[model samples]
Target: MHLSVSCGIPLIAPCRSSVKLPPPSPGIFYGRAREIDHIIDLVLHKSPARVAILGPGGIGKTSIALTVLHHPDIQTIYTHRRFFVSCETVTTADGVVLELLTTFGLIHDPQQGILPQQVLLNHLQSLPGGILCLDNLETLWDVETRATEHLLTTLASFSQLTLLVTTRGSRRPMHVAWTRPFLAPIMPLSLDAALQTWDAICEVHNEYSIKLVHAVDCLPLAVTLLANLAESESSKMLWERWEHDKLEVLHTQDSDNRLSNIEFSIELSFRGPKLKDDVQTVQCLSIICMLPQGLHESRISLFADAYSQVLPKFRSSIALLQGLCLVYSSDDGFVRVLSPMRHYIQAHHPLPDHLLSQLANIYCDISLAVH
Candidate 1:
């Protein structure tokens, strides 16, 4: 049966099929109420809600998407039709289509002469409507841009279907009219939210906890890791370890998963297609990571002039870094890396001495100009 509204109320009943739903919303989520509400409103009230939740690695994009999927209002409308597919392991358009078929139990039969994509499309067409959450879509899109966009365009053709995507980086996949007032890339948690999360995890609220969160720039994953450590180690000891180890200490003992390890999370971005082999971009990022404050936007020309050899492609490199969510531009016009990312980059990818000298000379010129 199709979804219908009566008296401005949705009269659609939940699907009765026995398909298993995604896991419940996170047990200890905090600091994302506004985002959750916005996504819910769009899915329930807007037409063709093709929402892309983009952000850096470990920024809780998947968690936010999961919360929206399991939301009461969402459950009422899209019930058994909701599908959450992880594109984390797939690397091609065909791979994504295969994932969709697998999620829907529509195994392709070569003897039946039906393409996998067509099988998925036919299955969805039979349903009233549904929401598809493609988590970590960048794995496919970054590698096979053209074919992936074609697949997205075809998927977007379904007027009844709503698409929710969570991917690393600030850029959304092209070929769809994503909901207006585009959701900016998710930022670090507010101080209060960070502290609340810390206290909830470790049952402690003190100066060391406050300093610990700030030291990680209030990034949720980093805060969560350090808090987990706080459960066993004293807050003071954690802080002292942080002072020495930085991102190294932001992982659980003997665990290195991206969610639990801040360094692994940053490594994913650093080794992403955008920044992996781009020497100039890597150099630019290393410089930003070393800067105590950040590289100001206005200083681009000065830096370009001073470090002409290293920054030959300075502007594009900066854009690439921002697109990957490795660095961000603040309201103060300075582009900065998050503390966890800065620590990771500094420890693993330190700039060469000659390049550092060039950066220092530019700073010297800027200081002289100010005086």
Candidate 2:
């Protein structure tokens, strides 16, 4: 049974005239050609590509999704069937159905005795081989887990439909067999790509420009924000301000969008359901943020001893932080926060003095043992 919609209600054709257009292609995209190509291949070749682009906030998930939505081959295959739904403001499973209905130009008339989900499913059944892109789906998935799962499971059952989603954090919603060899969560851009993005914006390739990109760890949003600042503010001055201001230096006075403000973007993750009320996890993150070299996995036991009263399950706390994309394991086996995130944590949520002293003593003991 492709759809469960009853034959009693008249199936409505999608009103093309009222359909909303997808956002314009990201004008200055870089470093994601491989990801885009892989996604295209999955959607084009696979029976029903159920792909999720997962990552932390401000890491270019939306930009990559938008770029794929506008790809030439994707445009040729999906045509007007392509629907891009921004789930940033949506928080419920029903809300997702409504967004899809709105995107399809179908009016939900409760008086007609049709469930909105049925209306949506019926409409989708009418249009075969369509692609749906849900951007920033974490807003919905985090708050309404079971409901969202049921919704996605139902959607994935349509073998002719392709489902693509972008969400903050490292996990995709469960129950759906996402395409094999799942796409890894997006990471910070490479130095080369970061420099290209910087030069494109500021047009000044110098020592300071190189230093600026490195300072932000080549995060796309951070690079773009700082590059825009570099256009008017001298690189030297901006570098100095970065030392004092950190994320504040990347803010745009005129805009409140998370993408335009590094602080706001980090705050969203900090305030997400997983971390927002979890004091021990925040403190654990602060400890990692305080150490430039990061907290080694082996040393977590020592830190747990230091804060045993406050952080009884320190190992799980660190695991939660990593799962949330707040801290990552470095190539050197240390768990490190990105430079921009480190600065934000230090300035706004520094470790308590007593805990800092304990950590200092712990490190001092390690050094003494080494000698």
Candidate 3:
């Protein structure tokens, strides 16, 4: 495909039959060539558009965006001046506008100590159109629902600029004129894809294929972490220990303050304040585990009421389960937990000892009461 030099728009294929792919970067880019193609179309297509790639955290949203923007066979339109803004730091919509103005070397003095939406609109209208990348787009919205939506709507309507956003939030206002992938699977690696990943890892770490896959769970972050870990220990020995306690080791909190990569990710999920009845909650989940694969929810509910003595809000329990990424709410309002329970039930990071004692006391009280 050829590109228009003056306007930076991608043009018709010079030789319709022979399509060439750009050279890929050597870093940790995984699946999603198809998603990247759509993104390239949005940004380099002959019109202005807003593109968004939305998905779960640590799921390679940023990596995929970088791949399209940096492709060596890529058109030079965006690379000349791609503005990378981290939306996580700038706290408000006004701040986001100010940040852009400052980055572009424009006079950024807010007229009345606050930027009017039109002022931003006019400024963007004045500047030479460029690709504006906003990562973690859902962050900085705070609790102001309307303000976030309003800013998004205004940004998407910019006359000449192309905006690409990476977020884990819903795509509503930002969905205006853009085209990007809407689905949210990690896009599982195919056999060819798997070989590509293993070859990439083996080139550096010299590990066997199947053993590496087993240790890392085949996720990009997991593979990267374990590949680095292989420099210190033989892959065989590591796999042996990992087989014994894979989930626990994945969140290995004691490894020199270094996140054993993917294990470090779960740390974010643990940041909020601990549950008030955490001891009982842990106990409740453990009891639920003892049941069969197709365990009944009513049975679990009855055990929760009996053992905890206090009836917990079913909603709170459901929210906790969701936050753990362990369970999903079914159509019938039942909760289905995800695989591999030993991490929660028998892992080192158990509920507080005090909470455990309190849970035991509650169970004894309930038992006596039942008699």
Candidate 4:
């Protein structure tokens, strides 16, 4: 008797190869349940062409992505075909593609005269389903838009593959959105959620810890860093010092997770042309930081001398700042900076005394008139 294995003409197989995914956070991940649920729905059920976990650095975007990747639903569907590419170190479009291909184990040999792109396509076709997480994508997306677009367009052709990109900026590549892309904007954790995280890190809690956490605006990265420091110092001392010198306290020596430092995290988010090159936006951030949180939108016109003309350029700068996650809008149309960010700007780029005086006078007049 003879036995034979029969298969379809264009043979297919479940993916067995392992890929280098982002390292899971060693600490407990708190908050972000709603985000995780929504993203899982989008990728596993809604079937969007692409999804981006867009937020500022240290907002736990990477941690959230890792959570979704390891979710039981995601794991069952994608079946270990998950891969990750850290776009932070990736400088070019080719570098981005090579990273993805290498993660999927597609590049067997460079001298084989086979294109890595084609290899990726072939492997993707054979897989039942797959998920790719592109972390820190703004490194390339900001400078190499056209090239990034082409790269996304090519990868997005595979309906079975889901691309989950994380970036500090809100803009999506022009190519990937054949349909509406699922955007999960990560905000800072709430006070209660932040307390839960703090509880895990600290053996004690008090007014000082609560105040310090709120002062950092409940940002997970900032909370984690300070909580670690709380191990050695009293929470009151940390809060007092942080209040006295926010940037000095936030500056960390950990080179691996630069986000451990509030200054480093914000600086990382503001890289590339649209942000680093735009002096007006930088100036606007400095001005906004000086005011109380949630400054009225109309008050931005006060920067008459800061711009060539305040209307057009100031508006553009604010929009750019919002896109870069350096600023955000409240429901009342008031814009505000995060606490740590406000602290970062105050330390690094305080407004001129004359401007500060002018702003104070304007506020004084407004308060008097309102009364």
Candidate 5:
């Protein structure tokens, strides 16, 4: 379990077990104090477990995990043994294993023809009370299912190590045994959290700020991007521009990271296994985007029938969207599309002329029936 002083990685300290988590994320982090507290209790105070932070992209899953990693309580336990491996760029399970090995300075010989899984398990099992974080795991799991499954299975043996994973989908692959008991689903920031985030960054909270946050579905990424803009642009002007072209306004100018744009982030979720191959699901989402916010399921059925599909078929598509955290059901049974998703669908996947005409006619008929 010990790490040598000459490991060649400056990020690791010369302790028995050295920490190698990502540098703390820049800017104000809000609304996740409770989440951090809960994760700390689960990992440290409770039995060894694998915790999954499930949510839509850009919903701050990674941020919350990082916060928990650096928390005072976690620091006290895993002071020098915390490791973070981002699965965003890794395409295979072997890639993930190597990343972890490199993080811990446990390089294996490629010529030996030995799999990294065995080496990793042996090391982690012997290590004591360390934290291992795997972020954006969907990227690797989707392509390398068997390898990812094997990796998780091996890691499960390390009762002394706590494992954390984040993904955009609600369901973890069943093979991984990431059951409901260890699940932590993250939704958009609450209105208060969103506003507090805005004011914390811009030092101002006004009507326009509220409108801007709500317009973006109270997602933390959008709030931060727009709040950063509020420093220079007037709130009124920022809100107006967001309404006109939100996807562009949400783009971060500071970096070349393609996923920095809120639109890009949501689009990645659309590529989940269920929706990636289903054109009907995408079209249905676009049509749903055209409806008023919180539109009832029955109204959606009418619209779907006008387009020559039955209510059940439409509901199926909605279920797929909901599974991906692209939409949610309100307390009154209305389905609500997240705001960034609404704008993305409207801007990037607009319905054709025939669907648009039928949608309008269906709404008219419903309006008449209601009256």
Candidate 6:
């Protein structure tokens, strides 16, 4: 008697070799598993909680949302059905509605002379349960839009789905969104965790105490990118290249999963037309950057000359920037940078000598306030 194993492809008692899969992105990618579990529970419960992963860029807001989607507990809860809209390519609100229509497996010509918002709301209402992860909402839609707010409230209060948002925006309409910690200072990587990250990024092992110190001062994105660079370059070379441009440390795209660490985040925080034509705004903000974090308004007022008549509204503008997640208040009473290392790198750019002297005056005011 002869027994044979039949297969689709010819199998001559073939030697099966294991196919190796690529490693995931580097950096200390530890997540808030407890928070993720809570989010899943919120989605599963009758009353859902809308989470807005709020923080500065490179602080890993999207990373948390993506991780939660893949969590085993979340998979069991959502049954692997979730809608993700990159929203990077989406410029208008109508684009969101179209993305939703496709995600829900509904077929309809977008050009059928029907606007997408109506189609989307109706379709979303029909689904029994779904979760929509809206990444980069600020970049995609107007924060001040009544339509956007209505859409958010409807998704939470009316639809079967929960909306998980990640943005640098404030937690307005408190019922609609909850602020998440992106700073990671509470559970920052231990030296061991950082070393593990280096090993994960490089082909061979390379770990040093000095490198770890630099990483401790770095945002997670920079740390991971550096770890990967260790594969090809000497540590001295990497550090020297990234020296003044500390943000340059975050440029490695090899760790695709770790894109949350992309250096472009620094630029995104700046270069908004919102700041155009506001020289005083620039000087005032730059002065704030120069001063220690969380300086008092009284001290800031001394720099009223920093912005002419505009300085009277410094409080409001600072609040606006803070709400935008470009900055955050500290427990120590200083408005420390939302991403400190990036701030230092950004603030390092050359300023007119006159401006630097003005900034020096602003700095002196803060010291006076301390005294």
Model 1 quality (TM-score): 0.92
Q: Which stretches of candidate 4 lie over 4 Å from their true place?
A: 1-18, 178-181, 301-312, 357-361, 364-371
Tens digit per residue, CA lDDT, model 3, 220-304:
5555565556556677776776778775545544553323545444333333234333644554454344333423454455445
* Local distance difference test values of all predictions, in order: 0.81, 0.85, 0.52, 0.75, 0.75, 0.55
**Using Cα atoms with residue i matched to residue i, what is each candidate's TM-score against the true structure?**
0.92, 0.95, 0.61, 0.88, 0.86, 0.74
lDDT of 6 by residue, 87-188 (tens): 555656566655555666555555654344554555555567766788777665443355555556666664456678776545443436442332222223
User: Lowest summed-lDDT stretch of 10 residues in model 1?
Assistant: 1-10
Q: Which stretches of candidate 5 lie over 4 Å from their true place?
A: 1-19, 25-27, 111-113, 179-184, 254-259, 271-273, 298-313
Candidate 6's C-alpha runs over 4 A off are 1-28, 44-46, 110-115, 172-196, 203-216, 249-262, 271-273, 276-278, 292-298, 301-310, 338-351, 362-371
Which regions of candidate 3 fall more than 4 Å away from where they truly are? 1-26, 44-47, 72-74, 107-120, 142-145, 169-185, 188-195, 204-212, 244-260, 269-371
Q: State the lDDT of candidate 5 residue by residue for 1-371, as single tens digits.
A: 21112223223211233435565854578888777777877876665757888888888999988887888887887787887899888987778877887788676765645445555655664576788889999888777777777677667656777888887777675555553356556878989999989989888789999999988878888888888888999999998897777778877764445346776677676665667888777887877788776568767656556765533367678787777777777778788888888878888889878778877787788789889
TM-score of 4: 0.88
Misplaced by over 4 Å in model 2 are 1-17
lDDT of 2: 0.85
lDDT of 3: 0.52
Best by TM-score: 2
Candidate 2 lDDT, 1-371, residue by residue in tens: 12254667687544333887789888888999989988988987886999999888889999998898899999998888888999888888888888888998888887767678888888777776888888988888878888887888888888888999998888889999899778988999999999999888887668888888999999999999999999998988888898777788887875668888888888888766888899888988888888879988888888888779777878899988888788888778899888888888888898999879878888898899999
User: Considering only N, C-alpha and C atoms within 3 Å, which residue pairs clash in candidate 6?
Assistant: 293-334, 293-335, 294-333, 294-334, 294-335
lDDT of 1 by residue, 1-371 (tens): 01112233322222233454676788778999999988888887887898999898888999999999998898998888888988887888888877777777565777666455556666666668889898888887888888877777777778899999998989999878899778889999999999999988998778999999999888998888889889998999989998987777865664657777677767776555776788888888898888888988888777767767756997888898899888898999999989888877778888989998887887787799889
Residue 79 in model 5: lDDT: 89
TM-score preference between candidates 1 and 3, better one: 1
Instruction: Quote the positional error of residue 106 for candidate 3 in Å.
Output: 3.9
